[model samples]
Target: MSAGVVTRLSTLDRFLPVWILAAMLLGLGAGHVIPGLGAAIDAVQVDGISLPIALGLLIMMYPVLAKVRYDRLDTVTRDRRLLLPSLLLNWVIGPALMFALAWLLLPDLPAYRTGLIIVGLARCIAMVIIWNDLACGDREAAAVLVAVNSVFQVIAFGALGWFYLSVLPGWLGLPQADLAVSGWAIARSVLIFLGIPLLAGYLSRRLGERARGRDWYEARFLPRVGPLALYGLLFTIVVLFALQGAQITGRPLDVARIALPLLAYFALMWTGSFALGRGLGLSYERTTTLAFTAAGNNFELAIAVAIATFGVTSAQALAGVVGPLIEVPALVALVYAALGARRLFSPHVSGSDRVRQA
Candidate 1:
């Protein structure tokens, strides 16, 4: 049953890049072919946020949250040797690095900057499994990292993302950011976007297991719904690009502009994290896991949160779409790099040991 789940996830991850691009094209096409359709979608607003976008964001986040078995959180603490470094790399250093890079790279484009910040704040949610597995990293450590990150993405991603938007600029004495008009603005946005899915996902996991049994929940039910986030992603992408078609048409170069910082972010984070782990003389298995985890981002949640906070047509939303465009191929390349570099680890840490450790 577990094998089946992993296989399905692997297949889905492999094809996700194609679907994201398709969604981008579809969105752009829909806007051009049917301007009225884009207008209609643009007209959708409820309390400053689009209803369809809110629903799509909910769909994108709920499955991710529901799939996490928070019950295993105890084990994460037990592996703090591995877990602690991952936490700092993912939450502390990763976000800071992306923020600095985004500011330095995209000085004039605040929306795109905010989007990159969102991506930075959100650590890998699901796809890191494929990344870690491909790199032959430690699966046990991956599980611990995933469990911890799942909880943190909910509790911390919003606050820290807001910090990047609202507080960091002031602290760094950088130009005032276009982000978060006020603290309450981001607080409200977080409640609607991240809060709802978090509650629903936790309750669904607990209640579904109680009603149907754990095996059914993980093996049968989760596999069924896990792909809904992607569906939501595609739908949201279609609507967003459709709505912003005119803007995108005028500024076709903006896509590439947004993508560059993200590409830089992935390369920078992977190398830095890998070096940090190796510098500590950590096992290759654990170091590889950290490298992948630190490099990956939960763009699903980031996209949802961006659209929720900014408008569907905002540059922030555009930044969200650009993330997957770069992350998929970049991480794939990193997988090869990790595999090729395996021999450089301590002689005591063999490939066979990684398999057993994972």
Candidate 2:
């Protein structure tokens, strides 16, 4: 990369928080100014998947996946130690933490509690890359973890949701009844949001390289196409806030009530991820990647599943909307925190070396 481009990229990274907040304000303002705008856009869905959300996810995820070194995937498997921690954190610890937090924090708000847990269950697929990038995380590791999480989300989300949302509530003596969500329903959302983008990113990277050359593809194509993901993220943020702006505006206190547990979840997960990575003596890059992969939530899939099972008007879906409203800013802050704390973690190592050590 050219010196100028490197400088520009750093500048972009630093300003990401500002841009995201601006998008939120603009989206909220536009939603209030133009009545029914959010509803009109949100109503455009196919098979329980919102088309705009799907598109935004596609744009956000493709570049990140495209950058993955597919050849290095084998190395990831061979050195399986680093992968286990993140898997445990993502699937086991993360979901359990959210479930506990939801019930503990929102005892009376069952639908909202369900929504928060759903967010936890739907690990990162789309925006994981942005957080990883912002934190200067190991890109290859992030890709591998994201792919793994996507697969797990498909198989586990429905059952876990049933276990937590239904069985747990009744088990805890809550009045909420058990609701069974079809596993395939959750799978459909994953396929639309994650599966397609994974395939397209792989194909686009391969074909573009074959057609043009490695040097041009890496230098020209990557730089040009990379920022599109951020744009897509900004667009997603706008739409999300636009959709839920009025509700948020009307009941700001309620929004704050819903946000409390989510904020706690992010902070706790990031800290634990960092400590675990360091305890295992992983490199700074891999450590940050693990932190983000575990910390970030796939709000799109969560929102889709929420609406499909709970109805568009349900508080469950509204809680799903609140996911991005809180997550974007929280993750942005964590990104900066990770970058600043990078030096404290310890000796930087190459990806291969880090994988081997972990």
Can you write out model 1's per-residue Cα lDDT over 1-358, one digit (the tens) per residue? Answer: 1343224335555455577678878887888888598779857877666677778767876776676566754554686667788888888999999998889889988778888888888788556755676566765566567667877765776578668887889888875544433344444555666668767888998999999999899778877886786677667667767766666666669978887888888999899989888888778877888899899987756766777678766788878867765776688778767766777876564321323111
- For residues 203-293, what per-residue lDDT tens digits would candidate 2 score against the true structure? 8778988999877877777777777878888988888888878877877877888899999999999989988887888777888888999
TM-score of each: 0.65, 0.91
Clash pairs, model 2 backbone: none
The alpha-carbon deviation from the true structure for residue 213 of candidate 2, after best TM-score superposition, in angstroms, is 2.6
* Model 1, position 47: C-alpha lDDT score: 62
Superposed Cα deviation of residue 285, candidate 2 (Å): 1.5
* TM-score for predicted model 1 compared with the true structure: 0.65
What lDDT would candidate 2 get against the real structure? 0.79
What candidate 2 gets wrong by more than 4 Å, as runs, is 1-9, 171-176, 345-358
